[model samples]
Target: MPESNTTLAIRVQGLEQKVPTLDGELQILQGVDLDVKSGESIAVTGPSGAGKSTLLSLLAGLDMASSGEIWLAGEPLHQMDEEQRANLRGRKVGFIFQSFMLVESLTALENVMLPMELAGAEDARTQAENMLQRVGLSHRLDHFPNQLSGGEQQRVAIARAFVTRPDILFADEPTGNLDQANSARVEDLLFQLNQEHHTTLVLVTHDLKLAERCVTRVQMVSGRLEAL
Candidate 1:
């Protein structure tokens, strides 16, 4: 185990990800090292196939790396079992994605409440309602994903991600599918909530404007981290 920094929200050392291909082992990430402090915002910008989303997944414990050290809030993620990692994610991580992965069957409010319900929270409905209101979605609470437009669905997704108020938030191309106006709106809300809650934010994006909004920016190319 590496020396865990008490003030760091996330730390990765010598991280690597490889997949066995017919030709040979294909490396997606190579010797990536990073340290993100608590309450800090980091933007990862790179071209397609640069492993930006893979890095975010590894940090959030949604995917495992072939070889690396990953510490989240001082816990050794690489050392944990799948179940243990899942439990940790439930308690400490939140995620938003490019596609706005909301359940089409569930209403906006229900979608927001799902995680809390799964965690056996006592006030799931109340918290869901409040969070929807916070995201300016109180009127759309009963709307299903398919019923909402792209921006509205993304708003629901944002509410769902933040409803838990996890210590860390990971967003991958959050505004990729939105128009300029909606993208700006979502960006403002994201930063506002992050400030209000002091949550560590790790974003994978192609948008330079979005990257510049973050406190720290890093570029990735050919599976390697580079200073921007």
Candidate 2:
């Protein structure tokens, strides 16, 4: 194990991920290292095909590393199996994707409840309701994903991601699909929620303004970390 960075909410060291190609192995991450602190917001910036999303996936333990380690909230992500990782994620990690991965079949309320229900959390309903209201979607509680606009859906996704009071939130291009007005709305909502919960934010973005709002900015180029 690497010497754990005590201030980090998420930590990675010598991390690498590769895939077999017809020609040879394609490296997506190359000995990358990073550390994010509790209550800190950091934006990951890079051009397309720069492995920005791949890096986020590795950090979140949504995918495995060829060789390396990720310490999230003081637990070792690499040491956990898929089921163990999933369990740990439910307890500690939250993810907001560009496409807003809400359950199309379930209403917004039920979608948010899924996590709380999985944890068998007491007072799940009350907690879920509060989360929906916090995201400014109280009136759309019974609405399905298709029934909401892109912005609304993203808001629902944000509500769901945050409902767990996670120690870390990983967002991949969260405002990518929205218009300027809606993007600003969602961006402001993120800061507001972070303030309310003091949740550490690890956001991957192409938006410069979004990146600047964070306490730190991490850039990637050719699958390597670069100073911003």
Error of 2 at 198 (Å): 1.5
Candidate 2, residue 211: lDDT: 98
Stretches off by above 4 angstroms in model 2 are 1-4
C-alpha positional error of residue 106 in candidate 2 after TM-score superposition, expressed in Å: 1.0
C-alpha root-mean-square deviation, each candidate:
1.1, 1.4
TM-score of 2: 0.96
lDDT (Cα, tens digit) per residue for candidate 2, span 77-165: 98989998888888898989999999999999999998899999998888889999988999999999999999999999898899989
Q: How does candidate 1 fare on TM-score?
A: 0.97
Candidate 1 local lDDT, 1-228, one digit each (tens): 355588899999999999999999999999999999999999999999999988998999988999989999889999999999999999999999999999989999999999999999999999999999998889998899989989888888888898899899999999999999999989998999999999999999999999999999999999999978
RMSD of 1: 1.1
Q: CA lDDT of each candidate? A: 0.93, 0.91
lDDT of predicted model 2: 0.91
Clashing pairs in 1: none
Q: State in Å the error of residue 8, model 2.
A: 1.2
Question: Best by lDDT, which number?
Answer: 1
